[model samples]
Target: MARFCLPRDLYHGKGALAELKNLKGKKAMICVGGGSMKRFGFLQKAEEYLKEAGFEVQLYEGIEPDPSVETVMKGAAAMEAFQPDWIIAMGGGSPIDAAKAMWIKYE
Candidate 1:
């Protein structure tokens, strides 16, 4: 059989973070930035969802805009320790973009 492992099984939009509820991972590392997700409480929702899914979820926040290479390395180090099967990025462009870089390093 071919070997292929996609990131996460599902991505729910609008309220996609809720999708974490169904994940089967033992751990999840969430990368976020600024305060939008927190202000709206999406970060809490995402964490709750992951926990509901039976995962030991943690967050790596304060990612800056146009994230730097240093930031990516630090995030990657965090993932190495968490050893999460899932990576949830919530917030603005900085978080998403930084999450992408972290993803590459994680793999």
Candidate 2:
């Protein structure tokens, strides 16, 4: 048998990042890949939004395309050390995939 799980809540559209303010947490770790998000200013906006939400935000940037085992382990170690209540995967799919692995290792 197989089971699938999904996030309890999903927010989107223009201003979706602002919804972070409604989340109940003190710390949040943002995982991002490459430079697009940074170049485009989404990364900064995310940090600001999280801060406005009262979270101490930490960033795990530079997750590469097709992420490596080493990267995943390093991200997991960072997560272990930071012990954030929320892990926000930003940017593209690579960061999100890396964050998922890191979350599993963190648990």
**RMSD each, Å:** 3.6, 2.0
Instruction: Compute each candidate's TM-score over C-alphas.
Output: 0.84, 0.89
Error of 1 at 2 (Å): 18
Those runs of model 1 whose alpha carbons end farther than 4 Å from true positions after fitting are 1-12
lDDT by residue (3-79, candidate 2, tens digit) is 54645654567988888878788999999999898999988988888898899999999999999999999999999
What TM-score does candidate 1 get on C-alpha atoms? Answer: 0.84
Residue-level lDDT of model 1, residues 1-107, one tens digit each, is 85544455435467677667877879889898887888988888888888888889889998988999999999999998889897888776688778878878787
lDDT of each: 0.82, 0.88
Question: Lowest-scoring 10 consecutive residues by lDDT in candidate 1?
Answer: 3-12
How much does candidate 2 score in TM-score?
A: 0.89
lDDT at 61 for candidate 1? 90
Best by lDDT: 2
Q: Which pairs, if any, clash in model 1? A: 12-16
